[model samples]
Target: MNLGIVGQAVGLFAVTNIDDVVVLALFFAQGAGRRHAARNITVGQYVGFAAIVAVAVTAAFGATFLPERVVPYLGLLPLAIGVRAAVRVWRHRGRGGQEEDERTGPGGPRLLEVAAVTFANGGDNIGVYVPVFATAGIVGMSSYVVVFLALLALWIAAGRYFATRPVVARALSRWGHLLLPMVLIGIGVVILVDGGAFGL
Candidate 1:
């Protein structure tokens, strides 16, 4: 039992750094004012990712069946997400009125909306995560959760920082609309390759 715990901890720590970086990059690219919406996003990300990990772990235990072929197809998800993000960037680049409304109600962004956006942003991460959790065994969950929360806090802080700085904010806001699509596409290609879509 001790060995199992230690092994899980080590595996989690190993993966956490990479995962956190990816998460941070994704949220950062989404633009400023994300902090206000980030609370819900963080919670949703945690829950959604936790569920995926749980499922992956369970499937590893042979409690459920997911085909080997299907795993590779997971790459398509990120690819699609990337394409959509690129499109959004293109659309927003030309249109001034299409900016996301800042008028989220007192309750903030809707919980489901937050969850949906987080999940969408997280699509590429999921492709990376599902395989990692599957191989890392059952011990990685606690460490993964802790690292995820830590990264979330950092992401929120970074968002706030970028949103507040006038010069930096304006520059980022301008380029942000251009950058998001490229980032998404890059993530998608990476995911596709990782998933063995190109035959490893």
Candidate 2:
């Protein structure tokens, strides 16, 4: 593994996934105290990321899986999720603990749900990774993959740390249900606009 390649991989992954920290933190906040919440989020993140990497690697090999214009359609996943969340909150308003209960209900956060969100949030990552991976030869690709996986663990730890901080946890516990939907919606909108979907 060339040190230069390692450094480049680290920098690229960090730049692409910086926003994931906040998103993961929000997930942890909502999943706190629920059974298997952390595990679900972690596994989901890895699964989603693995999918993105698979796509990028495939594209790098001369097989295009997604056209640029279609990337923005991915935003619909998060937008629908956010809308569903908002509707749930609205429907349960004034139910006195029911809302929170539903939000953090028995299943915790579903692994697939988390995975979908992670993947949806990673359109930019795919765009960035495809070119980088394409330029990296076999050896360099291996190094990049290893480094990216390692950094993903670090990102998870950081998110967990933030979610567990007393002040942040308190605020999130109180408002996470509401904030999460809004954040998801906002992320969707940003993706749509950034990708020029629907002409911004």
> TM-score for model 2?
0.94
Candidate 1: C-alpha lDDT: 0.52
Alpha-carbon local distance difference test for all models: 0.52, 0.87
**lDDT tens digits, residues 1-200, model 2?**
89999899989998899999998998898788788899999999999888888888888898988887888878888898889888977986789776556555555567987888888899778888988888888888888999999999999999999999999999888788788899989988888888889987
lDDT (10s digit) by residue, model 1, range 7-75: 654455346434433433344445345444556645655665555555555655655544555555555
Instruction: Give me the runs in candidate 2 sitting further than 4 Å from their true place.
Output: 98-105
**TM-score to native of every candidate shown:** 0.60, 0.94
Q: In angstroms, give how far residue 178 of model 2 lies from its true place.
A: 1.0
Off by over 4 Å in 1: 1-22, 28-31, 34-36, 96-171, 198-200
**Using TM-score as the measure, which candidate wins?**
2
